[model samples]
Target: MENKIHFQYLIDGDDFTRAGEASSDIKSKLKMMNINPDAVRRVAIAMYEGEINMIIHADGGTIDVDVYPDKLTMVLKDTGPGIPDIDKAMEEGYSTAPDNIVSLGFGAGMGLPNMKRASDEMEISSVVGQGTTVTMTVLF
Candidate 1:
């Protein structure tokens, strides 16, 4: 079996019912590969959060995942309005989601903070009008 694997998934912006499918698939694959439960949980949670963020804020996006013997990497790219303040965005309770979004059970504003806490390292590149890309790595 290969010690490394790379996978990419497209997040459909219009499908609220299918938001976490990619993360679920990855979790299943990691389990079949015998990855630790804790590791799989972290990956799933962080990636799921990113996916929801893309759906809620970006209008849709892409997720790339690299699985290695000792680390896992995820990159989420979106085309929606980019974050104006990364610093504020990182704060646990700071969120700009609309009331409509909150009514749907998301937008608690814990996406970035939770992703950072779940991964070993995280980087964000965003432009106000261009887009946002988040790269996160978890060490095994």
Candidate 2:
């Protein structure tokens, strides 16, 4: 591709049924674009985890994805109760998800970690009471 392709998605808070829609749609779009399969997988996994996080913790958010010739970037922004400790949140098996979400097999405390692992690069910014924004990039 010679130019960047962009996509935006709105996540519905507390809606497990619609949690993965954004990732799925992005996956399909990437596939149709003939993007590298591995890159597509990375984007899908990372974005899906972020999507689920929004539903479980942030009460939904907005995801913006940019597809470039050399990489794919995803920005997940939420206005929910922001994370108090980003370092703690990034650790595996460290989750703030409630019992109800855990019961549904949604929160295993691996969301951010998995997102970081799947993406080539990841950055997170948050304010304790305001919100959080996560930016991730995967090389194509």
Estimate candidate 2's alpha-carbon lDDT, on a 0 to 1 scale: 0.93
TM-score of each: 0.95, 0.96
After superposition on all CA atoms, what RMSD does each candidate show versus the true structure?
A: 1.7, 1.4
Q: Give the local distance difference test score of model 1.
A: 0.91
Candidate 1 backbone overlaps, count? 0
**How well does candidate 2 score on lDDT at residue 118?**
99
- What digit string (tens of lDDT, one per residue) describes model 1 on residues 13-130? 9887899999999999999988888989999989999999999898889999999988899999998899999999999988998878888888888889999998889999999988
Model 2, span 1-99: residue lDDT tens? 559989999999967988899999999999999999999999999999999999888889899999998899899999989998999999999988999
List clashing residue pairs in candidate 1.
none
The 10-residue segment of model 2 with minimum total lDDT is 12-21
